[model samples]
Target: MREDTFCWGIVGTGRIATIFAEDIQQEPGMEVTAVVSRSRDRGHAFAQSQRLRATVTDSINALTSSGNIDAIYIATPHSDHLPATMAALQSEYPVLCEKPMGLNVAQVTALADLAQKRGVFLMEAMWSRFLPAMNAFMTLLRQGAIGEPRALFADFGIDVPLAPDSRLFNPALGGGALLDVGVYTIALAHKALGRPTNVYGRARWTETGVDGHSAYTLAYGSGAVAQLFGALELNTPQQAVLCGTQGRLTLQAPFFRPECVSLTRNNGETNHQYHPVTGNGYGHEAREVADMVRRGRKEHPTMPLAESVAIAATMDELRTQWALQYPDEP
Candidate 1:
């Protein structure tokens, strides 16, 4: 809890949890002091790999209630986010939850309400927003590097084993291309253009009836349009471009992290490359959380709590248009 050294209690032992652990570990003033998994075996495995001298518990309550942890990071599955986040916030622990805060907007909205009423620090761990490349790119856009942003073209796609058990194809676990990889594309669009005045979506479903390959277009109140795409059935460029009246910006693969970034103004183009400054570029968000907690702030100004709820709402609208609903959802 000290300002100079923040301790993180992580919940969930998934792949993203590993990345989060790595990123938070390398932060100058942060350390992951504990981890909670569904099973003791899984918890110890993560503890051993991360090489932490912290407590490993199978119980979310144990980790959230511990005085040893200064903050909580929830990296559980899509369906599990609400419980983990609710538990942490209810314990009065500051929390940084993974993106898509929950399976739907209603879930996240309630959490936000609780956070507000409880006066606990809470934020969606939208790591991409804190990336060096992303920040710089946004700075350019603000400076009219891309004047009057008119359109955004973004996509993410990959070929994965189509097994029904896989999270991408399973409807019961809140799995689908839109909620998974597609979220990244949509998040970027939100940054460039706020909420759209209208939303539309269409998708090709998998055998399990979840979204397989899909595309959507968003019309913003500013008269700007964002064309987005996502797919688990095939491979895509995984790139993005924002076009405007004065210029355009192009982001390389993994547009969220953007190993490469470029700016074009009326015909002249300049490029910049950023290597992993830290573990998977997630350390940026970790550092931001530490600083915010140090300042006793409840929400990150960069990725405000309100905006987090809005993104979830946008996703809900998209899913509705496609008539796609997870088994556990209405």
Candidate 2:
């Protein structure tokens, strides 16, 4: 432990939490000093497996009030994100909650309001926003490397076994293709085009009554458009393309965490750029939270609470169109 270490208290000992613990260790001044899980046994196992000299407890209060932790990372299931994040914010601890933030617009809006009232640092762990390649990609777009953005295309898809009770398919767990992997596409489009003026979408539901596959189009007032897709039962190419008046930029497969991008001009010329990731690419966001907290910043500029709210609202509209509602949503 160094004198300038930034300590984290992680909630949930699941896969995301484990990855975060492992990646944070790669950062010079950051560490996961404590963790809380629904099961104390699991918490202990997570600590030992990660070889972390940290505390393992089942009480979020104890972890938050430990006096040594600088922030809290909530990696619970989608349905549990709101409650877990609320607990951390109520404790006045900065929080980095997992993506989607909550199951619906209302839940996410409430969390944003609370974080504002409490004046604590709160960010959605949209790790892709902090990726080196993503930063470069955004930079090129901003610099007009592709000209005025006219349209964008992105998708995320995976083939997972059907399990009604699993996190990815369970209605009780707030499961669906839209929330599970679709958020990356939505967020990427939001970053590139801001809020859309109109959205049109439809979904294919699973036997469990959740969306197994979804596709949507977002239209902007400036005539910019984004076509996005997400699926749990189909393995669609996980790539993204942004087209403009002068050229187009393509992010390779798995665009969410892509390392390479190519820009193609109308003149039939293309240029490739690569920006390598660090430590599974999770540490970059963790470092951002640490840096923001150390500087007394309330939120990260790239991933602000307002944009999160708007993204949630966009999903809310789509769900409204599909007549989809989670068991936990009011």
Candidate 3:
């Protein structure tokens, strides 16, 4: 490894971690040098598959204090995000944790506070926000291509089998459509509308006690609203739309990682655009974190810690409405 290369230490060996490792490998002057997993055998296998010439351990402490890693990425299950991220921050490591950041608002807020006190760089891996297409969409909105924004509609639903042992339906693993894919819808809404004046939601519970299907509406002070839906028990279009006084923008299916968007104005004028990504779109966030760390910044402006806390609060409110609580959550 080059002395100037930015080395990363990953805290999980799951699918997302594998994707991250793959994407980071495509970046110049960056490398995955260490990984932590509960199972040493799995960690070793992951390293070999990813072709990482790095350490494979089961301890977060070892990864954080190796004196070689420049930053850490937490890709563990939802329930483990808090503990893993906490360990990284306490060890004075910059962290880019996966979405939902924590199980609830309290946990997310605590992490933000700790990172602030340490003056270290900490950001939620809301990777979608950094996508090329999403950025282009935001730029158009800002330039009034959609006029005054008035409403939004988005949903992400996939039909996964009813396997109680899988993380999707397991309460102990922080399973549920809301925590898993629903955050994308809410995040897009939050990006366009900021914090909602009020949040209204309803959920259908699974036999395992977690939410199976759910819907929510966020109300803003300017009379704007966002309608969002998510489900693990059903399949949906997985599209999104933003309506304005004079026009509307629609993102193609699987909107969270969209490549195309269409804008139609009231005057019957229309425009279509495409924005492509490199390496599954995970490298964008990795590069952003590396730039911020090298610049000595403590937080990302686009995916700030405060906004992550706010989004977690919104999710907490929805869980409260459904009377759903994870077993391990305090």
Q: What is model 3's C-alpha RMSD?
A: 1.0
Candidate 2: give the clashing pairs.
Answer: none
Candidate 3 residues 145-257, lDDT tens each? 98899999999999999899998899999999999989999999999888999998988889998889899999999999999999999999999999999899888777988
Q: Tens digit of lDDT per residue, candidate 2, span 1-330?
A: 787999899899888998899898888998888989989999999999998878888878878766688999999999999989999999999999999998998999999999999999999999998998898889999999989999999999999988998889998888999999999999999999999989889899999999999999999999999999999999999999999999999988889988998999989899989988888899999888889999999999999999999999899999999999988566
Clashing pairs in 1: none
The lDDT per prediction is 0.85, 0.92, 0.92
Per-model TM values vs. the true structure:
0.95, 0.98, 0.98
- What value does the lDDT take at residue 117 in candidate 3? 97
Better model by lDDT: candidate 1 vs candidate 3: 3
Candidate 2 — worst ten consecutive residues by lDDT sum?
59-68
For candidate 1, what is the TM-score?
Answer: 0.95
State residue 132's C-alpha deviation in candidate 1, in Å: 0.7
Rank by lDDT, highest first: 3, 2, 1
Ranking by TM-score: 2, 3, 1
Candidate 2 TM-score versus the reference: 0.98
Which tens-of-lDDT digit does each residue in 166-187 have in candidate 1? 7668888788888888888888
